[model samples]
Target: MRFPFARVVSLVVAVALLLSAVSGFFALFTARWRVASLPGTQQVANHTFTEQIIVGEYRTCVTLRRETPATNDSDVVQVRREENCYNTFPVNLFWSSRLRDVSTGEKAYFIGVCWINRDRVARVLGIPEDVPMQSLWKRQCFGVRSASVGTQAVAAAMAVIGGAVLIFDRNDKERPYRGMILIAGLTAALSLVPLVIWFGVVKKPGFDVGPSLRLAGFTWGIHLASFLALTLLHFCHSRSEMARYSGPPIDREVVTTQTADRLTPTQARAGQAAEGFARLESQA
Candidate 1:
C-alpha cells in the first residue's frame, strides 16, 4: 500500500516485456522468410543477373546465367545457368533456401550446399554429389550475415531478461536491474550494426539494396522501441520506490516539545518571569 505506484509501474513493465518476447519470437522466423524470399534473380534482355542475397541468418549466395559459344565452326551460342543458393556449412540452422525462378517458374533447392570446408561437413551430412559448391568467400562474407544473427540473438535475450526483472523486482529503489538494462542496451546497439553494413558495405553494383535495407531498418526499429519502453518503465518505478522509502513529514507539536526539553535552567526561569510580568501589566 505504501508504494502503490511502484507496483503498478512494475506490472506494466512486466506485461510489456511479455508481449515483446512473444512478438520477437514471431519476428525472428518472419525475418528469415522475408530475407530468403527477396527477389534475387532477374532477367533483362537475354541476360539473367542475380545479386548476393542473405537468406536467413547463416546463408548467403548468388546465382547468375553464363552464355558461351557452343562450337568453334558455327556461330551458335549456348546458355549456361548456375542458379542455386548455398548453406555455407558449420552454422546451418533449421531453415534452408528454396527459391523459385521467376522466368521459368521452376523451383531450385540448395539445401545442403557447403561452400567453406566442404570435405569436413559435407561427408558427415551425406549430401549428394550433384549439389555443386559455389564458394565465393570473398564476396559472400560481407559481415551482414553474422550481424543479423547477433542482433536477433541479443533481442531474444533482452526480452527474456527484461521480462524476468520486471516480474521479480516489482519495487525499484533507484534504477532497474543493471543486467537487464545492459542487455537491452546491447540489443539496441547490435540492431544498428546490420543496418550500417547494409548501407555502407553491402550495397554494391547490381545489388538490390532498397528492399533489404528497408527490412533491416524495420527490425531495428522494433528493438529500439523495446529498449526505450523498458528504460522509461524502469525510471518511473524507481522514482516511485524512492518516494516510498523517504522518511515521513515532521510534526510541528513534536518539534516544539523537543525545543522546550533542550532549554537551559536559566532560560526556563527567565521565560516564567517574563510571562508573570506580562500578566501583571495586563491587570494594571
Candidate 2:
C-alpha cells in the first residue's frame, strides 16, 4: 500500500504539533503547582500576622515592631524593617511592597522572588534561626503559564489543520496537491507567531525563569521542528511540480545539432539521398 506525498507530510506535521501540545501542557502544570505551594501568610512577630514575604533573586528578612495608639481615638500600627539577608552573585527578579488587609484593616508587606537558586543560597547563607526564609515569590511563573497556554492552543490548531489536509488532499501526479502545500505553508507561518511572543515578550529574566524556563525551552524547540518539517515538505512538493511541467529529458546538444543541420533545403535533400544510397548498398 502507498500513501500520497501530501498525506505523509500532513501526518508528520500532525505528529509534531501533538508533541508541542504535550510539552505545553506539562509546562502549564508545573507553573500552577509552583504557585499553589506558596505560603499565604507569615508570622512577623508574637501575636501578629501579615502577608508572607516573597523571595526572588535577592534574599531578605523582615522584622515587625508593633506600636500602641497614643490617644484613645488613635488606631494601632505596625512598623516593618527589612534587611537584605544575603545577596547572590547572579541577581534575579524581585518585587516587594506593602498591602492592606481588606478584612482587618492591617497593613502587610510581601516580597515576590523569581529565577534565583534558593536552596543553594540558603545553604551558603546559613540563615539565622530567627529569620524565616521561604522560597515563595515567583513573578515569572505567571508568564510561563500564559506562554504555555498559548502554545497549547496553537499546537492544537496546527494538529487539526494538518489532519484535515492529510485526509482531504490527494496528489494527482508527480507533485503533492497545490492546495495542501499552500495550507501547510500558512499553518507553519502562523505557528511561528506564538513562539516569537513566548521567546521575545513572555520569557523574560524576572518574569519567566527557573524550572519553567526549561519547560518553555522544550516547547519552543518542538514548535520550531514542526515548522521546519512543513517547510521542507513544501519545498519537495514544489520541486516535484516543476519536474512534472518541464517535460521529458533529452540530449540538448544532439537535438540542437540535428535541427541546425536541417536549416538549409540542400542539406536536407543531401541527407535523404545519403540514407537511400546506404539502404541500396546494404541490400546488394
Candidate 3:
C-alpha cells in the first residue's frame, strides 16, 4: 500500500542518518583503531598516560600520536623487553598514562581501550595484574558517541521535531496528523544525528594515503544523501499540497430555505373539517 510521501522520506532519512552516523562513528572509531594498529604510535614516556587507546568491548593501549614520525616497531619491541608490565595489546581510542615503578624498574601501563562490540564485551583483559583497567573502561565507553546522554536526547528531540514538521499537516481530516508528525520528526532528527556526529561534531585526524581516504569519500556521500532527503521532503510536501487543493478550484454553495406563499386549498378545507370534528367531540 502507498503511504504518505512524507513518512517514506522521513523513514529513509532516519535510516540513512542512523546508518551513516553509526557508520561514521564506527568509521571514526575504525580510523582510530587503524591508528592504534599502526606500527608506529608509541613515544618515549612522559611519566603518565600520554598514549591513546580504544573504548568499547575491549580496551587496549594505543600510542597517542596518530602516526608518530620518530617511533618505529623495532623501538617498541626493545622498550617492551625493558618494561615487565607493559604488555603491548591492540590500540584503541583513549589515551594511556605512563608510570615507572621505582622499586621494581617495571613501567606500569595504563591505556583505556573500547572494543568493537560495545554491547557485549569479552572477558576484560588487564584485570589480572591489578592495574586500574575497569575505571579506564568506564571513561572510554561513554566517549564513543559523546560525553553526555543529553547529547543523544537533544539529537533525538531534533529528529522527532523536524520529522514531525516535515511529515504531517494540521488540515489532514482523513487521519490524525499530529501523531504522524511526532514519529516522522522523531526519526528525521534522530537520523541526522549520526551525520552531525561524524561530519559535524568529531572531525577525525588526517592521515596518509590508504582506505582512510576512501572511507572519507563514502562518508561525504552519506552527508549528501541526508541533506538531499530533507530537501526532497520539502519539495514533495509543496507538490502534494498543490495537487491537493489545486488553487481553491470551486467553492461549494450552501442551499438555504425559501418561504412558502400559503397553504393549498385542499389543506385549508381539511383544517376546517378537523376543527368542526374537534368542536362536536367537545360538545358531546
Give the candidate number with the greatest lDDT.
1
Candidate 2, residue 21: lDDT: 56
Task: Give each model a TM-score.
Answer: 0.47, 0.39, 0.34
What global local distance difference test value does model 2 have?
0.47
- 1-284 per-residue lDDT for model 2 (tens digits): 88676556667666665666566555544422111122314443343333222222223332223333355676655454333233221222344444333224465444433344544333222332233343232333445434435554665566566555555555564233556445545545544554465455433222234354455466556556655666677787778768779665679888987796757888778877998999999999
In order, the Cα lDDT scores of the candidates are: 0.53, 0.47, 0.41
Q: If the candidates were sorted by their lDDT against the true structure, best first, what order would they fall in?
A: 1, 2, 3
After superposition, the stretches of candidate 1 with alpha carbons farther than 4 Å from their true spots are 1-56, 60-84, 89-144, 172-175, 209-216, 233-284
Worst lDDT 10-window in candidate 1: 125-134
- Which candidate do you rate higher for TM-score, 2 or 3? 2
Runs in model 2 with CA error above 4 Å?
Answer: 4-7, 32-152, 167-208, 246-284
C-alpha RMSD by candidate, in order: 10.8, 12.5, 13.0
lDDT of 1 by residue, 174-202 (tens): 34565666666676677677667555654
Q: Which pairs clash in model 1?
A: none
C-alpha lDDT (0 to 100) for residue 122 of candidate 1: 25
Q: Could you tell me how far off, in angstroms, the CA of residue 198 lies in candidate 2 after the best superposition?
A: 5.9
Q: Any runs in candidate 3 off by more than 4 Å, and if so which? A: 24-105, 108-224, 243-284
Better of 2 and 3 by lDDT: 2
Can you write out model 3's per-residue Cα lDDT over 1-284, one digit (the tens) per residue? 87665556666665555554444444443333222222333332332222333322222333322222345544442222221222222344354435443223355445433444321121222112222334434443556344322343454455445434444443452232444444444544444444444343333333222343345345447546655555655666667778888453343332111111265778778877998999999999
